[model samples]
Target: MSYPLRRRLWAAALILGFFVLWEVLCLALQVSDLILPRPSQILATLFSRMDVLWPHILQTLWTTMIGFALGVIVGVVIGALIGTSRIAYDTAYPLLIGFSSIPKVAVVPVLVLWFGAGPLPAVLTALAMCFFPIVVNIATGLASTEPELEDVLKSLGASKMDLLLNVGLPRTMPFFFASLKIAATFAFVGTVLAETVASNKGIGNVMMSASSNFDVPLVFAGLFILAFLGVALYVVFSLIETRFVGWANRKSDFAST
Candidate 1:
């Protein structure tokens, strides 16, 4: 009856409908399990291998968290610097674009070379993958500040730093949190890529190992775990955005609706 209950029911129905469709298609086509296992099969594999998967899941979670933390720190500082100054923005924006264009997966090997194949490479890769979006979003937010507002602040005897600290920083919060949602997903991609490339543990390694043995269900299970982790992290950041940036959120949602 309530809107919230209806939304939850609708989401649940969609997910259930998807799994049912998948199962029906697999059965109707007589699909090979190797190519695509059924959802039930995947769930069975996941539960059977719970002991094996738990450690790798924890490994991935901590690596991603560390990398995400590092990314947030670097991204916020660099983003603020570039956003507040026209000179800095002009000089750095192009360079940032160029840097972001490079595939982070390509850097995993180099990280492995330096760090000698462990969690370090995964952490660094995740940090690298996540920082770019945060930088761009924060910078864009700051750069988009109303010129008239800045002029008014200047007329009121506000120094550049004072204007930036008081006005620019608040404007940047919504963008920063929004970017974190995207960057959190990227952090997962980077960590898993690094793990598959050169790590002894993590879900990526488990998937890779399963692939070698032709254990398709296990591979899918690892993928499922990774997807769960990413979604969970995204939800956490979304909650944070709702709490800390509710004013901007309310305005945006109102406009959209």
Candidate 2:
């Protein structure tokens, strides 16, 4: 088989093996459906309750995508500014680190209070959760640019704008995309958490309701949906990265093997 086909088959086998092991363990332990439902049980519940769950899932997805886009825009703009300026980097870097260190979850209540218990709060929560990683990744990538390259650009009398557009931006593309994958996952988590705390609509609300009603299987189903969404977003971002950063990906593959 070709390498790509072999990789696809391997991925399928891995997933199948995982489910088989999970099913075996659950059966052998006779795990209670209330405490830990098997994958089959979760899948069954998900399908059976699709009508109830689909709207909530769509709501969460909408908030997540909006917040993620906003966060990425803000992050890239601020990151590029800081990355390109030594004074700005020194001045803003410490504050960025300090804010990023603050537990993002702790701000959920404040966001709800400020934005009210709706999509706005949830979107803001996701934006806050996702922004930091992009900034850090872009800044790091910018700082790590080869000094020789900068020297060469300077020798060629490249303007600051030229250097930023031609060299700095391209170098930071991989980091930007990498952070996007991380941020997408975080954005989902943040939106869900905000929904759990404040909103009547969203997957988190469904999960919360399931928990309160002691619907263990349903709770697991909600979790499964969230996990699937995160994976889907990650895969989408990875495809984007592969398309845009083909050279970087090829280099990475070569380094690894």
Give the candidate number with the greatest TM-score: 1
State, as a TM-score between 0 and 1, how close model 2 is to the true structure: 0.91
- Model 2 is weakest, by summed lDDT over 10 consecutive residues, at 248-257
| Total residue pair clashes for candidate 1 | 0
Taking the tens digit of each residue's C-alpha lDDT, what string does model 2 give over 127-159? 988998999888878878789998999999999
Angstrom error of the Cα, residue 46, model 1: value is 0.9
Instruction: For residues 1-257, write the lDDT of model 1, one tens digit per residue.
Output: 99989999999999999999998999999999999999889999999999989999999999999999999999988898898777998998899889889999899999999988999999999999999989989898999889899899999999988977898888988999999999999999999999999999999999999999999999999988987899999999999998888888566565544
TM-score of every prediction relative to native: 0.93, 0.91
In model 1, the Cα lDDT at residue 38 comes to 90
Off by over 4 Å in 1: 2-5, 251-257
Predictions in order: lDDT: 0.92, 0.91
